[model samples]
Target chain A: MFRAGEVDALIHLGVMHDPRARPAEIYSWNITGTTKLLEYCQAYRVPKVVLLSSANVYGPRPDNPQFLTEDAPLLAAQRFPQMRDLVEIDHLVSTFLWRAQGVETVILRPVHIVGPVHNAPSNYLRIPRPPVLLGFDPMVQLIHYQDTADAIVAALAPGRRGIYNIVGPGEVPLSAVLRELGREPVQIPHPVARPILSLAFRLGISSFPVAELDFIRYVCMVDGRRAGAELGFRPRFGLRETIHAVDEPA
Target chain B: MHTAGVGLLDRLHKLRGQVPDDDIAGRTQALVVRGNEFAMRVARWLYRNYFRASAFGIEHVPATGRVLFVANHAGQLPFDALVICAACFLEPPTPRLVRSMVEYFVPTVPFASYLFARWGQITGTPENCRRLLAAEEAVLVFPEGARGISKSFARRYQLGEFGTGFMRLALEMRAPIVPIAVIGAEEQAPAVNIKPLARLLGAPSFPVVPYPPFVPLVPLPVKYRLYFGEPMTMTGDPDDDDDVLDEKARIVKSRIQSMIHVGLREREHVFW
Candidate 1:
């Protein structure tokens, strides 16, 4: 209500992703905060809105396609309560997008975003000699922190409106990224690592939730074809460059 | 008979120094599996002398570029994928490797996971498959997934539910789908009994077998026959209707099933 005439575009990137926080707190903050923001946008006639969504919404499933698109089911919330808040926010924003006449909404789902500030999946990407499951080497899809900033900037440009999967260039094995960082892979047997990681988390030794370990065990890649086609946004860094720039294990 | 094991190491020694493009992990992982020389050689030997595997339609496989080989998963483990990989390498005009899509739980095994990556296996993610295909690498997928490989001995050769992801990927990537039927592998480690402990064992199927407890769990030498049918041309968007996806998958399944019938009629014996 305050910036009625001044603000024409709104970039919604604020999220409370701390797993330690109470789910109820996270929900109200995201949901209610977003509603107020949308209310302001509506009151102020902010025509363009861009949201930074996550590829994690596509949950890790044995049957998940190698790369997910924007149309893929947001199944992560079904399993991880931690993800429910993001999905709810997205559902609300999307529902708002269509119901309102003048507002054009763009939702972008990006893969593991790594850089100065570490997200959930990025935290796993940095630690030296992280625990790797014995027989699995899942593909790692990442966007540089700078490139993510660039994507958000691109999303706010005038005429783009729709859901898009924003992925970085190139694909490599997670083992490759670990090696590039000079970290030794601590191999853990799959059947056993599940509980051990959970216990480690419970013991306050590890920050990553054990549930998200499935990403490392399986594929969590997303196709960025739509973004490339529509937004005209291409990641400046390739897989090698992003990995080298993001995590310096040494 | 002399072992080809040592002999294969000799070949890998010559192909060494492919490290220029590899990242730190790819290089380190190669050290673990020795560029996957030993396992590949063993699989090659198994496909050649052990299984006496013969191929019928490798010509359908493109000498270059991305092509999807949809095969039935059997033999309890991925012995079927191994034999298929062997066929691609051993009897080929172009000695390109076929990257078989593996399960997420595969990395649970420490040593084997390294070998899988070194040997050119990628996790079965559409994005992974799509990338490999875009790079023009040959990718193989078992649409039946763990279900087919773990099927009961009595239901052997019965194709399980065909996952439609491969079909959509085929359409999306615009790669031709080659339906392949592998015979004899179903009997390699036949599912004599699917143990109730499959869940406890954390495997798709824990089959009670005929082998004694102390006996080495080597897959019995079964004469193998592989049939590669014509590649089907895919049309439509990858984001097509679920029914369309199901029908597309069924079309490929029926084709493979028919090929299995042909292979069954032609296979001289399960074991020579």
Candidate 2:
């Protein structure tokens, strides 16, 4: 597959991003399928590789700082199995980079990437009456989808290989973001929010899984400094610009 | 009377100037959190008319430097914190926005969380504290946590066991610890007993104030006197033994307690 186009670097932007996908289906595409692809890359001897990971790997823990570094432990997967697979996939890729004979790998973990196609947070925010956990105004960082592509391209530029958090310059409170979107949130107690979200998803009303709702409940921000300095990748859209992209109508 | 009204409004416009205008700055993070301007204005009004708050030893708060204000948390909610911040912002000897280290459970609520973030309130995490200190910003901490605020009416004036994290953080960040004693806050909405009803709401505490029994959340009118002590410096490994950390915490606790005693002695009346 790799020798066909004289491809010097292979970037894996394909991952089961939507948590609403059935567990088995998501595992097949994100976990097992990703492995099969990486194995092929090794067999085909692809010189360089880059994997798109989510900053959600950090998890929405009470202790998580507003800005997190790449070194932070990947705990998001523990809370939501959906995230668990991404961390597992990251673990696999990281291990491969160290042991693989010739592949130079880079992992990019970006916060909510907004664009024409709706992502988790964007999809959640679009609900006419979005449900927010009572109390948490966890700040949300946005990166333009194009910016993510730019980061992947920057990683393809060669040099160092490892993990980099591709993030934007500023963050707006999740509450303010909702206000900016002109959406009224139904405040639900945290304990009840999970079950309600689960039921809503079961009814096919919710676009994403219940576990991903933690993003709206706690702070899980990532520091994008390394991406800018090491990969020469910077986000083009400012805070309001990226948010407005999500607010765009269908 | 018309001239007096205009003068007051003009003075208020000047007070609004102290609140960082984040829109023009294009900065996010803390600066972007201009807080609820209306809420702040109300807080300002209360800082003057309600509490009639006054500050002493303001010079101790450095003109520009990373500082941690370790104050007694009381008055059911955080009246002490509001009045202290108000005292700092309103008076100009050392005017600086003081970021309050909010309890971990604080951000779990809706509008309140939004207001706190707008007011530059960060979760009481060591990482957040370190970042603020590194940036040379002032942070207000209630090391007593719920223990101090939830204390029964009898123990209102007493400083509870201080959390060792602040001391360890102070040691780690090398940020000077400024002990603060907020008088009269203990008298406002004094919680006689804190019921475990917070579990129902998934909240941290649900203190039971004796007055107005139905509305325990409302605080009574009380005068405030905020005393800022000399900057206390510490030296030692932040990762020192538990006993060492506890001992360090005790020194600051004692300092605040002594200051509180003086504040209590000086205040002629609670409703002054």
Candidate 3:
């Protein structure tokens, strides 16, 4: 599909298809596969490209501040191997598209993308505990799935290039989100939760990789000002509305 | 101490019995004496003032006997090693003074080598390594070697490929490897700019080189924190092959890298 000359822009989705594979394997598929596709784009002289990268690239930042900007360094030491791989793939795609090929590449590091069709298991929702609250002080930045899709469409428009961190209208605590869903969650200290998570990985009951644990302590809070200012993006839903956007009907 | 105050010629003759004429120790001692006066003055000043460097996890450093102090290399500066030497040798109740064997190029410069030799620093040769370890003396080696110092500024904290010689020596001598992380060395010179032309002319980089600001200026007030991780003992079989030795070296290197990262994360600021 990427090689077809008729396609002006190649949007490489299907990256999160397999969550069970080791983080390295999943990353190889995203990063290596994207490299090959980018090579094809260069050979074909494709003028524009948009890659779907995760906001998890920001990793965990403090919840008190509750906003992560694009300028934040990508934290690669987190416990989730997949998240780390996604972060690496984002760098690879951005570097190849912007630096190597000189073709316009727009990267979207969206936070906790959610929507009605988002049946795929996500860290934000599938967390083992009910309330899913971060320890004592936790901050979370999220984006509605519809808004994420719209941002993609906006980037696909003519003559748009650069990186953007997309998030919903506001930030919320994991516990707050869980409360909105009417489920009380157990608040476990990261130190305590980390070992349990590691045991899960060992027992093959959970897919969380060791690297992903780095964020459980630091909550990534990014600024969405650029996405709104430059891309003319205005999230249509707030945290409460977006939480319910994906909540299954009773 | 008063038993032997021999002339230079007499000392040269006396050394023949203990060290062969072709051996490098004679030359090393001569170099040490050449710079002995200046090194003492500097060492005294460093000890009296600005020697406030404190170490965490000092227990990680072996209390006695043979040990390997493996650490990260930050550019061409020897300040980091000097600080380590001062802390270990000059501090109160010094626990088993150490000798750091550095690269051959370090002793190439007349003044630099003299001070280095006077302070018990030696060339990092295989023979010197075996001799030092055999004496059960603590030895310091930057396994990353020259590449670690020569790497571009952008690669800071990302360790370069480590040479396996240190690990081999440790295994051969059955010594414990103590990983040390020295924060703030990178900020001392900062390497803000590199001058390739000056380098070809045998001159140091133009601005912000790794050495002290001026060839004569003392180090500025940048705070340094050295963290030592628990010693990792080589448990590999004595008859392990080269591949095994290389793997052991990598494991040691990774542990050092982790200690460095942890130290950096714990620090509030490197420049303070």
- Which digits, one per residue and each the tens of the lDDT, describe model 2 over residues A1-250? 5657466877887777665567887877777888887887888888898999888888987667768889888998778877777888888888888888588899989888887666676677677788877766677887877788888888887676889998975776776677767889998887788888789889997667887777887788888888888888888876667777776665
On residues A43-102, what C-alpha lDDT tens digit does candidate 3 reach at each position? 787877888887777665321123446766776435345565567667878787557555
**Model 2 lDDT tens row, B24-80:** 124333244233445567778989888888888887878788999999988778888
Using all chains and alpha carbons, the TM-scores for the candidates as numbered come to 0.78, 0.86, 0.44
Residue A94 local lDDT, model 1: 80
Best by TM-score: 2
Candidate 2's C-alpha runs over 4 A off are A2-7, A17-21, A36-45, A61-63, A97-102, A124-137, A174-197, A239-241, A244-250, B1-36
What does the interface RMSD come to for each candidate? 4.9, 3.3, 28.1
CA shift of A208, model 3, Å: 3.6
* Overall local distance difference test of candidate 2: 0.78
- Tens-digit lDDT string for candidate 3 (B1-272): 11234333333233223433332334333444444434544653553455446677775666567888998876456667777765554332333456877676543343443345445676686556777777778888888876665555567788888877888788778888888888766555555445685487564433354564433234554566777788888876645787887888888788878878888888886555
When summed lDDT is taken over every stretch of 10 residues in candidate 3 chain B, the lowest stretch is B1-10
Model 3 in CAPRI terms: which quality?
Answer: incorrect
Question: What is the TM-score ranking, best to worst?
Answer: 2, 1, 3
